[model samples]
Target: MTTLDKRQRVANPTYEPQPYSVTGYPTFRSFYPYYLGEHAHPVCLVGTTISLSVFVRALLAVLPLLSPAKQFAALRFGTQGWKSVGKLLLGGLLQGYVWAWIGHFFFERNKPATFKHPFYSLLGDLTLWKEVATLKRRP
Candidate 1:
């Protein structure tokens, strides 16, 4: 709403993202082909790769604090650590969506399924990320 509100929101992010699923597809196997179709544009693929890289690195950075040896609540990351988590998660999400949107609107000329099918779209992104990472497919 206001500058103060934005700062407060960023300082105390209320959202915690978790993987979810919808009835959009009976199984991920059934959905992969459709996901591939939506991401046919080269720009979309590139954007996805970059976003996933950032997100994975961020997740890795934050993961040690969550390990069983540390006992999640007992391990304190303080302000900087928290900020790192926020930056990685938010930055990757924002970056990916922006590029994907641009590709969809300008190049691909299609509406992103992310709006209607967030869970499936996420699965699609991760799946593609794996393919690209393993050099199975080009992103």
Candidate 2:
């Protein structure tokens, strides 16, 4: 497999919770682990997976439109049509928003790192989704 950058490799690294201080906001490195921990619930994982998949598909669709070369490549690959993908993405976004709000308002009841540390949040979402899937398969 191709090697990842250091940031991506440790995208979901564990956190070392220090005392809440009056300094600036925690950096991405400090927030990612906490984000992962918050997504331990199976529902959260499922919601995040659905959301991210839609987000990525939407991004792919939009990217081609912005660049002719990419548009041609997408057509060649039979992935040029994007209206359905756009609708799916919208639905996914709504679902993700609901899940995130639930986590913030009821479960975690705290700020989510996705607002500040998007990359790590995505990584944590995938990791948690995998864990939840594996656990479900076990007897």
Candidate 3:
């Protein structure tokens, strides 16, 4: 039997970064192609999703605790609850924000994908989370 050539044995790559000319556009629609390019690395997407999930959970938890009706009336008007909620929101925001920041700052600083492509960023986040779940279930 004839042997296959070594060059032909190599598997084709699945992902390639888009060229700068295609990715450099300023509009959200235009930037989405580049944003999709950045998400080829699953870890970045997963980290962002996890961070956002944690932030939302924290916010929901704090809402009841911070509500004026949930606490004593006299202390409610001027007290720590509002401050607590503000801190919680800030902390949650930082968690999600930092993940995207790290990806932009460290990995793909040239394109800065999330700045103009919030929708695709969110799509990447959810898609990565689903991938993680599927992988975890594999035998």
Candidate 4:
């Protein structure tokens, strides 16, 4: 096909996002073991911890300014409130992405497993935090 014809045709017109799932292990318990293995690198531990810490700090800074009821209100109701939350969310996401990419590419020298297992990876992160807090694991 000519370049012009290719440009005119729709690319992936039927594209749709599929639900995330792990093979074999349908539950978090079944997947936790594999998740831990992926995050064995020290960099992954520190990266995810810093990312989550930033998010919590941001949320705490803005919590006092917003009433519980206003939390669910539209962004227009309280611009400051929404902006604070937005900043936290964006900052946390950016930090997480950057740290994960750096850790995987430089420290671990492997592609992040999150690419193939998002949900499980997320849960694994939280589980890691729990383990650290309970003195079951070190970061």
For every candidate, C-alpha RMSD to the true structure in Å: 16.4, 8.0, 9.4, 17.6
Residue pairs of candidate 4 with colliding backbone atoms:
none
lDDT of 4 by residue, 1-139 (tens): 6544543342221222222344556777766665655555667767677778877776665655655666634433235766867777788878887888888788766676678768877877777767656555544
Q: What's the true lDDT of residue 97 in model 2?
A: 71
Candidate structures ordered by lDDT, highest first = 1, 4, 2, 3
lDDT of each: 0.66, 0.57, 0.53, 0.63
The candidate maximizing TM-score is 4
Clash counts per candidate, in order, are 0, 0, 0, 0
lDDT of 3 by residue, 1-139 (tens): 1223432332222334665554356554554445455555544664566666666755565655656575534333224665755666676667777776776667655545456556656665555455445542111
**Hey, what RMSD does candidate 2 come out at?**
8.0
Alpha-carbon shift of residue 38 in model 3 (angstroms): 1.0
Clashing pairs in 3: none
lDDT of 1 by residue, 94-131 (tens): 98889888988998777787897788788877777665
Between candidates 1 and 3, the one scoring higher on TM-score is 1
Best-to-worst ranking by TM-score:
4, 1, 3, 2
For model 3, what is the C-alpha lDDT against the true structure? 0.53
Which candidate comes out best when scored by lDDT? 1
Q: What pairs collide in candidate 1?
A: none
